[model samples]
Target: MDKNAATDAAAETPTQDTAQEPPLAGRVALVAGATRGAGRALAVELGRAGATVYVTGRTTRERASEVGRTTETIEETGELVTAAGGTGIAVPTDHLDEDQVRTLVGRIEREQGRLDILVNDLWGGEHLLVGSVFGKRSWETPLADGLRILELGVRSHVITAALALPLLVRSDAPLHVEVTDGTAAFNRRYRENLYYDLAKNAPIRIAFGLGEELKEYGGMAVAVTPGFLRSEQMLAHFGVTEENWRDVIARQPDFAIAESPHYLARAVAALAADPARASRWNGKSTSSGELARVYGVRDVDGSRPDALAYFEEVRFSGKPGTPDDYR
Candidate 1:
């Protein structure tokens, strides 16, 4: 048996949502690439909403993933979920490997028997990736690397969807979230480099394609982005802790509107629990801040930082403004 397989453990009810039992109680979710950042937080949030989440990623205690940046592992993420009142199962999976991903889905079937939500938050394939890890001009990018990146960034997503389709369709109105770096509107401009731009935009396209296919089955798919995410890597790059992330604004004012990974988690949790209109967001590109308005969930700081709005109004407009301008 795969160490990742479950043992028919009893389901748990999230106690944090004091108003009532969590809407996702007894639900099962698979959060791919959940070792860190938005994926980690999203898995935790699903747990908080009373969902049994199988968290998969390459980073584990026994091995460091290609990200080479953090010790955060999928096991730690699962532990956090369990602590938050939902079941968390950790599975180290390399999404690019068809055999590994296939076995993962099979384990889920043997254990949980159903998969209700599928969040394709895959990344962390830089070493195995086809393109330059450092953003390079299209002409300058090595052809082999560029093609491999297409496999890592784009093909991995399709592989997951193709394999998970059977399990996902079993649930009523299953929700699939394809996490991307930017909204479709924002990615219209170049993003540092050609490969990077395409990689980011690919997820949105995947969501659109899946949205079209899933509609017939009464399921939904959407591309989601976090507003200027203060992910672990970003925070490390800025040389600040989440406790003092404000310090980064002095060097990069755009950082002022940065949101935690949990913000994206809130957006996902809200969508999953929305029994009435979650499908309305299908084929759309959304952010945690915008979804805050629809779902009424705030960031850890209790304010919704609309990063895209801030970028357009303050960054692109060449105007200086406080974070409040966006919040």
Candidate 2:
């Protein structure tokens, strides 16, 4: 179904359950940035498929990380994973610190013995996206701030994969998912900020770079992205909760195409289960909507909205029509 049809159907149905056997049973997975958003959702979804998930993040119930505005901690995400039926272990580690990340992986090796899936989702750079002339050229933005984005967003992914790839390669059919925003086709246009554009585009390149190395060991890596995600912090931005998010669509019609983190979560889960078809997606820059069409999984209230398609046609074109047709 298209985005609009799915959204309309969601409004009519209270719930849509697509039942399946636990495909990931006996598997082990790790999400490096499981504080919230895509990382948290990926952990829970993997658990739902019966994979023991190691969730790592800086935030805990005791103290918050740099993104301290919200209270959703890594411990909470781990608990949610366990509640969903798989073992969840929450380890507090600052991904920016290579030593801390190495130690965390060591613990996972000690406990799980093998790592089947690795999700490098450690993005804590949003706190530094500040400046009067933000989203300017590389020379325009503060040099330190721009480099800081590379440190938190790009370097952290490299560090986590550097340490974790060894263990992952030992597995039967390992999958590495590098989460980012916008697909390769969508991000070709300059995102305006040097750091912002680089940070977002690096993951796409990582998948291709890593895929070359991983091919030797029959391992795979792909950069994954969600459509406009209605994450917890995003909900707060529109001054509404998930329960009442539809209300904001009136003000910003494009909001109608926004999807929950679970959409991407399930997308990765589907990938983990279908390792035989790994070559089809290896090294590709993909999104939740692209996978949803293939897997037939549903999003919030079973609605499948494609934010990229809407953004490309409507948001980018500056069309003055409502999202009623698109989503």
Candidate 3:
């Protein structure tokens, strides 16, 4: 379905049963990189749970951030969060800068008094520079370019997390989430992209390291990934509209089964609601499908797009495909 169709369908559906629950009422959350994609969705989901959310990102109406591609802005995300039933604050920030990140958190502390959740969704430009791919080597692209990607993808998250730690530690049920892509064990050079692989891997390690470090403070840290995210940017890249997203399955069969950002957002909400969630997911990296099973919540379409299972089944069954085979 296209965005309009989905919106209309949502309008027709009954109100969510959890609308009255307010699992996170009286809580404050900070979602870094909330301008678009997973970060934006997570902020809205947290809001649905009844938490005051601070949505920070570099992209704004006045000026665009490092990544030139445009979608929603932090202000737009904040509005969505507020519409979901919580107060939303949009703060323009570039996470790559340590001082900016610190200031962002300091302002949150001043306004909210305490932080309950922190989600680091910063990503470098690996996916953005798809044109640079040459043969099996990502390094063949450029040295300086790769380093720049590292700064945004890896360093930004580190800096933001460092600045937010003190405030997170002060919260009664502190939760930290590092967002990344895919699983660690499934690591196959990923189209032979060296910097991209490392940047993605680093977040998982950060989660594990922070999980151990925060043990003393009774805090939890974990990494989360979405399966085949059908993001607005990705749909535009593929020349497909959400209404006809299934059309891309012909080009990449796995694309047929895509999950919306809301799927992962629900996962974060479930984790925040669970009192024992820290013990279960601390230091671990999990996927949206896995979280759906654990939380018993459906995706926006009310279907569980189990991308992992689809991959496994295809691999075992030896499905035949080409760029347009699944179409």
Candidate 4:
């Protein structure tokens, strides 16, 4: 289905329930940087599971951030979450500003009393990937651009977790999801750019260190990555729409294993709803494909695309196989 059709269907009738009550009924969640992509989907899925979600981002209907895209806004994300069956509150926040983060957390605490899930998905450095970052040595890259990437992808996550954890720990079952570009194992090799490498890997360590700290309070922290994600920005990059993304596979063969942002969003919702997530996932790094398999969840198109496995066994390894074999 198209995005609108899915939203209309969800708004008219909730489909995330198989029991008497939605799994996350009455829970409260904060999805940081939910203006678009996986973060936006995460907010909506959490709402579908019956959790009140506070979605934050730098972009609002009134303004756009440095990422430069104005088509999507946090206000629209908030509406989508509410339409999906939970309370959605859009809060404009620049996590790098500690004061803004502190106020955001304070408002959540005042309005909800406690936070059940914290999803740190605040990276917005993709615009730096082309001329500014890629194919350059650390010495060759622009210092300002490199630092901006770290500020957006790494420091923001740290700031959000630091300010939000006090309220998050108060919940009976708290989940902290550090969303990043690649899994710990996958990122062992250099990511072609020094700054990008550090930016992505930092979240994995954040989850590990936070897990150690949060365990004492009965909270779980895990790093999660999505496969070749077909995000809105990515679709635009490939010059295709979600409904016709297959047309680009001929030029970009690896795109065959691409999964929708909703795949990772569902994985996060499953993690939030799982009673034993602390024992099973705390301090570990995982991917949407791995979680989907564990939770028996499928993507919107009804397939579980394991892009990492495909890359490791086929693309990088030069094994003779098609993306279909992995997807």
Best by TM-score: 4
Clashing pairs in 4: none
Q: Each model's C-alpha lDDT?
A: 0.83, 0.85, 0.80, 0.91
Least accurate 10 contiguous residues by lDDT in model 4: 8-17
Clashes of each: 5, 0, 4, 0
Which stretches of model 1 miss by more than 4 angstroms?
Answer: 1-19, 125-135
Q: Score candidate 4 by TM-score against the native.
A: 0.95
- Deviation from native of the Cα of residue 320 in model 4, angstroms: 1.7
TM value for model 1: 0.90
Worst 10 residues of 3 by lDDT: 318-327
lDDT rank order? 4, 2, 1, 3
Best by lDDT: 4
List runs of model 2 lying over 4 Å from the truth. 1-21, 130-133, 317-322
- RMSD for all candidates, in order, please: 7.9, 3.3, 4.2, 3.9
lDDT of 2 by residue, 1-327 (tens): 566876775565323244754888899999999999889999999998889999999888888877765579989999999999889999998887889988988998998899999999888776677552255677877888888888888999999999999999999788899999889999988776878888999999999899888888888889989988998888987999989998998898778888899989987888888856467788888989888877767686677678887888777877665454544
100, model 1: CA deviation in Å?
A: 0.4
lDDT of 3 at 3: 72
Model 3 lDDT per residue over 167-190, tens place = 899987789999988666544436
lDDT of 1 by residue, 1-327 (tens): 122221211111112548788778999999998999999999999998899999999988988876785559889999999998899999889999999999999999999999999999997644533345465577887777777667767888989999998999898777889998889888777877666678889999888888888888788888999988998887887788999999888888778788999988987898888876445688888877788778767677666789987887777777877666786
Q: Per-candidate TM vs. native?
A: 0.90, 0.91, 0.88, 0.95
